[model samples]
Target: MIKLENASYSFKKGFSLSNIDLTIDDGEFVFLIGPTGSGKTTMLRLIYMNILPDSGVVRVGKYSSNSIKKRKIPQLRRSIGMISQDYHLLADRNLFENVALPLHVIGYSKSDMGDLVIEMIEEVGLTGKENHLPDELSGGEQQRACLARALIKDPDIILADEPTGNLDPVTAFDLVKLLEKVNAEGTTVFMASHNYSLIKSRNHRIVEIHGGKLRS
Candidate 1:
């Protein structure tokens, strides 16, 4: 579970988010929608502990989000999978290496790593591209590789910032459906997207952000 209470953030003397109050239950999927600069990315960043809230409280599972010690940030991040608006893959690494990066960092054995990478690649419907580099694949395929990496960790939560933003409509819909499937299996999902119509059709919980404040 994740909870944000009266949270606010500011940068360069400008407020990006304010007084945001929300609670996400375990195994639930939520769509966060708003225009660009409406604080959608900021909110997702807060959940992943990428940025600390200047005020208020953020609790993810049993961890303190904004107040955790610096060294603990990586550990905290490991517990939550994140996808960015752009596919953030290591250009130098093949799909397998990229997906296994996190598991390797945490010290999974070679055999375990290989198995896990294969499983994740299959999970994301990219079974035959494990050896391809990010540059070798199309944008949508690269995004799937990124998602494979995120889910390979099997984090407690999945926070995505427009995971399907750059994909074609059919690909985007498939990705959203995959996210829902992940939610069904008990991982909490918090997705930020500008595709309001797509989100609305799913009938999930939504919390809008505008001018640095959550909507009423």
Candidate 2:
């Protein structure tokens, strides 16, 4: 679960978010819609505690941004998976290694890692491409690889920041449908997207942000 109450934060570059109050329940699929520079990414950052609010409170599961210890951030992150607009893959690593990276960091056994990583890659519809590098794949393939990496961790919550931003409409729709399948399997999903027209048909809860504040 994720919750924010009267939260506000400002960056040195002059952007500011004010008085945000939100709650996302477990297993709920929520879409965050807003214009560019509307603080949608900032809101997601607060959930994962990438940046703390200058005022008010942010709670993601049991970790509170107001009082979370620095050492516990890794623990918090392990519970939540993140997919960014920029795939952020290690260009040197092959698809399988990229997806296995998180599992390796968490000390999963080699056997478990092999089985789980392949399962996730297949889920994302990239089975044979496992041995390929990021440069060898198309944009959509890279994003799906990122999704596979995120899902391989078996996170309770998924925080996706503009996951479809770089993909074609058809590819984006396929990605959204994949996310819907993940949500139906009981993982809480909170996605930030500016492409409201593409996702509006999904009929999920939509939270809009503008002027750095939540808008009805």
Candidate 3:
């Protein structure tokens, strides 16, 4: 449900990601691997609607990302769950509030909200800490909260950039396992990670992005 054709992204004058042609099918778990500054996150930004590409075309769920309407960005983003290395959460809000924020913005009713929020919290294994604020949680807990928030949207595709970058090894492995479970249940996951050793055991389609091009 995500496609890019001859896409390229240029930031200022020194950095450019060129000739990116990628197609991610529904329910497929794909991994994007590379070193620092290799355009991995840049490619994801195109998919997540955070930035427009300098050239070429990108389409997701029948929407042309390069020119999608400003007002529609929220709708488009709701269709895809993005978990970047930096966990984006409202510090003022508690964990439950943060995860339920999306549903609330989308107009989910009180009856529907409780069960959905609780289900997502359970899935992410954060059942009891629902009342804790973002600042009260550790990095891993915050990341889990982010994951719960992402899943609550029930997105068609999940774009995670270094989801486990700073976690301990055990936590990182457990996190990937959680992702695998989500994938098994039909969420298409495109994970960008430099931790190849952790992912090697998963045996999913590994796509390497480096020097602004996709490696075969």
lDDT of the candidates, in the order given: 0.87, 0.93, 0.89
Give the residue spans of candidate 1 off by over 4 A. none
Clash-forming residue pairs, model 3: none
Local accuracy of candidate 3 as per-residue lDDT tens digits, 5-118: 898888996789997899999999999999888889989999877888788988888789667998898898999988877899999999889999889878998788998898
Q: Which tens-of-lDDT digit does each residue in 84-203 have in candidate 2?
A: 899999999999999999998899988878888888999999999989999999999999999889888889999999999999999999999999999999999999999989889997
Rank all candidate structures by their TM-score, best first, as comma-separated numbers.
2, 1, 3
Tens digits of lDDT, candidate 1, 117-173: 898899999999888999999878888888888999898899989888899888888
Per-residue lDDT of 128 in model 2: 97
Q: By lDDT, who's the top model here?
A: 2
Name the better of 1 and 2 by lDDT.
2
The worst-scoring run of ten residues by lDDT in candidate 1 lies at: 61-70
How many clashing pairs in candidate 3? 0
Local distance difference test, candidate 2: 0.93
TM-score of each: 0.96, 0.98, 0.95
The reply for model 2, stretches above 4 Å from the true place, is: none
How high is the lDDT of residue 132 in model 1? 94
lDDT of 1: 0.87
